[model samples]
Target chain A: MLSEAEIETLTGVAGLMIPASEAHGVPGADDSAIMSEIIVSAERTEDAVRNALAAFAEVGDSSFQQSHPDEAAVLQTIVASCYYRDARVLVSLGRKPQPPFPEGHEMEEGDFSLLDPVRARGEIWRKVD
Target chain B: MKTDPIDVLIVGAGASGAAVAWSLADTKMRIVCMDQGGTPDPTQFPANFMDWEERRNGPDHISPNIRKAPSDYPINDDGSPIKVVNYNGVGGGTVLFAGHFPRLHPSDFKVKTLDGVADDWPIDYQTLEPFFAINDRMMGVSGLPGDTAYPADRNNQMPPVPLGKSGEALAKGFNKLGWHWWPSDVAIATQPYDGRAQCINLGACLWGCAQGAKGSTDVTYWPHAKRAGVELWEHCRVSQILVGDDGMAEGVLYFDKDGVEHKAEAHVVIMAANGVGTPRLLLTSTSKQFPDGLANSSGLVGRNLMFHPYSFTEGVFDYPVDGARGPLKSIWSHEFYETDLDRDFVRGYMFEAARGRPPVNAALAGYEWGTLPWGEGHHDAFRKLNDRIMAFCAICEDLPELHNRVTLDPDQTDANGIPVPKVDYTLSENSKKMLEHSAARATDILNAAGATEVHAGYPIVYAGWHLLGTAKMGLDPETSVVNDWGRSHDVKNLFIVDGSVFVTSGGLNPTSTIQANALYVADQMKRRLANLFD
Candidate 1:
């Protein structure tokens, strides 16, 4: 539902939200395909969304990105929600890209020994008077 | 909805309805159940695990308004902050529940006697104890055998599910605070029982269990109840209850999948619909004998709607807490379960370890609560928050106020052309005070557990899981709708056996108690078969 120009604007805005970190190997929202994924979740019509993006993108690159907090927040939330859906992003964050069920993640059992400390002190339940 | 002449006709095949059918399996009575929702399609649920993003954001979202499937009847919850959370399928809300099975304490039944707020339940915990034991065994409960925090009982069938990193951290905080912390008793089996498989720890119990590990009634009770000769009709919407000229329930009139009207004549009619649904069904069933709606002589059909108000607080740790592996609610604290004169509120709240949302949910939650700020630093901020956070949800006890209620919306109707339910609810000052207190305490516990940051939010729209106290049980016909055994006071053959009969919404989860009440009421019905109407 996004025009090429609006996609460019969204790409610019997404970078501002979570800029590409070369040091950490994290892709920016634009290059990482988060804006495309965000388009999949857009509830608004293409004309309305494009028009909204036009005002922000026209304001001299980073002008509206810094100035319009409402649009910035709206775009940031959408992009971030979609950004986590990317398997590459998930792996970089040390998370599995797969869905949580059917084949569930295998977690290492916690130090069950840590519970002994609490148990050693005896029961802590207050008596019913 | 058309069926043979039935000895007992139950309106819902949910947690309560399925339990009642199973409990009465040995009686060899001709029982049939009518449900608006079909059995959950595990293949289409989060179980199939594809379209995870769209399903979580759209079709499989917890609220029926978003899911908007054919089986779900739309509810106008525009008037309330906590939107209704329910599923229409055979298992009912249990299909989407977290399986956090905590029983009500003895004090929960005596809220009015102890704290002078709300009416005391006609029946007490002592009266429901045996039924609770029965339900625990039937549902395959898992927990430590003798939790000192509760009345000593071996009702727990299996050892507690292993406490993950989040559980260990939260347990430390509770130990440090010297409060009562125990592994929560959940309905999900850790080991195979009664022909069901052990839990594979699939993260989305609320999204429909694919492995049949989680104890949604369709997988648990309905299978056995059906084997015991109880017929379940899916896509059967009961539009009204027919009352005979003698002021007794005759049968139910319902609509089928093709909008064809059908009838099931029965001697006894049981309403196992949830708190909101049970009353809405009754309010729509107006007859010459019950012009004001059947079994509503007390004028309490849909009044006193109580959903446990909740607050969520997440703690950020330097280390990873991959809580997404096991059941969502494995550990909890009853530290604030009792009333204290020092607090401004009459009752208390519970602190449960909330875990295991996907990355999308976690990101949305972090941003919604303002822990993860937007702009250039957002990625790093979410990085610090994502899988490294442990959450604590304070489930507050809601008092029954006469003004808070569910009523029929004149402007809205479902696909079957029945008027839908409209909720009018606002959090009470007592609950608000309790939430503030509970949130602060939760933050303290998280901080003590060595968190770098703690985030808290009030009145999120998704906290409407526990539906209770609409058609409640009591001793007087003038004051309450149902009597001690969940039989309607005005109509002898009519009964309500669900969370709808709850006198008060306790701080803990209500499903176990809902099932326990169903079992007790069914047993009472069996004993009184000779003179059920007397």
Candidate 2:
């Protein structure tokens, strides 16, 4: 579990990673619901998450992004994993928020005449007995 | 304890095992198949959950060492550059395959005769042509079949999958270059057939098809084999093949899910444990008669490993190609599939166009490549690449080398305490040359496709999907492990019907040919049953 102070620190960092976009109508990773999901997801790799957070805290949030790229990437992965799955974010990307099935998307059948050139090339395989 | 002896016993209920069992079901003889993995549940497939992308990178990973399911055995692949990827279940690798199905060309079967390279297969493309057609119908292949790259008479059971914007973009590139591109033959149901639903463009074929549209052998052949009275025992891991004093196979000793040991006796024992697992089992089953291994008089049970050396280049377009909208594999090019004496390499490669990555994967990949940044500009960078990138993989033909082998691990064992397989492999100079050439050609195609940016990576470390040629087939018992009909040379009642019997690892995916070889071997078994023991 994260203390209130750590959560606040994480919120600031998340906002820096992905700020709220008014034009796209999508909340930033710092949104409470998304942060809650990220915190929950952190439990899967608790040690690594804690280590990354500690590293960021030690470096201080202001210079963390500049001084520590590898540590920031750890937090980036955690945030992205949860943030991309959020309904608003998915919709902003023009994707359905729900699972891919039992309602799948339709695809357009492309033009087969695009292969006229290939077809005109004739048989290219070797003749073997 | 020993069970009653059956007419035939098959170890591993995977692609080849399922097909062989189904093909031999008409014989009316008592048959049994043992598989280590449990049956899959469609409701629990990753695509059914909102976190499908996360699951694909996690529990549903293609590498068994990473997935670590109870049925999966760990492979010690640290010594090799390429890692082995597999699914240890009823459907085997088919369960997680992208279903880009293609048959070996006629020239592939006679490599030694034409290219003066690896030994030629005892059987040719013509011999497996009928069987390939049979498998196509059974698997419900979908494609537009006048591909000039292959011989005449190649047909598809259904119309081709939608090319979508990504495929069309790549096809235009190939057309501009005057190269050979075709709608790839994929083992996915475009329309309803064989009791499966049509593909709904879930774009999650590699994580196990949630719609039951991909032709995994569990759905394609296991159902028919079971209906024909072929008993399938799941969660049963075979430890070794037991041989009688008369130098014949006497079934296998295996462990059930409970870790309890049991013995299954049979007149004939068929090994379909794939190239790695099959050789691992053979090397582990050492005895007084054979000494080295069962049916290993040629000392070639676990030698001559081959994997299609893989490379790819991704092109990023300004507009949305919607590359993640449909099946993973859409179109392919055979322009460089055949060998040319003028080239530096002996055999050639095929160019397979792949769909873009899922959103999460796309973001992660961008970060890895240092394109999508961490802070201020992450979203913009991601938007520019997501669904706008198209990738073309070069599946190069790797020649069989005796030094590249799968041997018994000196230390590690699986959860069931069975000795695990250790792989020792190195990329040959020929393969390296081929990968370099293919990457350059792929860049040309991507450039022709009007891409704003292109990135290429060679010798993909995670692409050991096509495991083959560890125990090859040939006419001479002194050189090969199995005979022309997949029968063992040293052990009369033993047979291997998997990729282990492949003499050459053709550039294309091997599942179609693997299943065809299995059906052909089954037919041969039936034709010579009266004199099979001779």
State which candidate has the highest DockQ: 2
C-alpha positional error of residue B298 in candidate 1 after TM-score superposition, expressed in Å: 0.7
lDDT of 1 by residue, A1-129 (tens): 566666767777677666777665777777646666767655443554565576676574544645765665566556766677677788887766777665766644455555555456554443423
Query: Taking the tens digit of each residue's C-alpha lDDT, what string does model 1 give over B382-438?
Result: 777767878889899999988889899999999989999999999999988988998
User: How well is each residue in B203-285 modelled by candidate 2, as lDDT tens digits?
Assistant: 89888899999999989998999999999999999998999898888989999999999888889999999999999999888
Model 1, position B444, has a per-residue lDDT of 89
TM-score of each: 0.93, 0.97
Candidate 2 CA-lDDT value: 0.89
Q: Candidate 1: give the clashing pairs.
A: none
Fraction of true contacts reproduced, model 2? 0.77
**CAPRI verdict (incorrect, acceptable, medium, high) for model 1:** acceptable
For all candidates, state DockQ relative to the true structure: 0.42, 0.68
TM-score of chain B of each: 0.97, 0.99
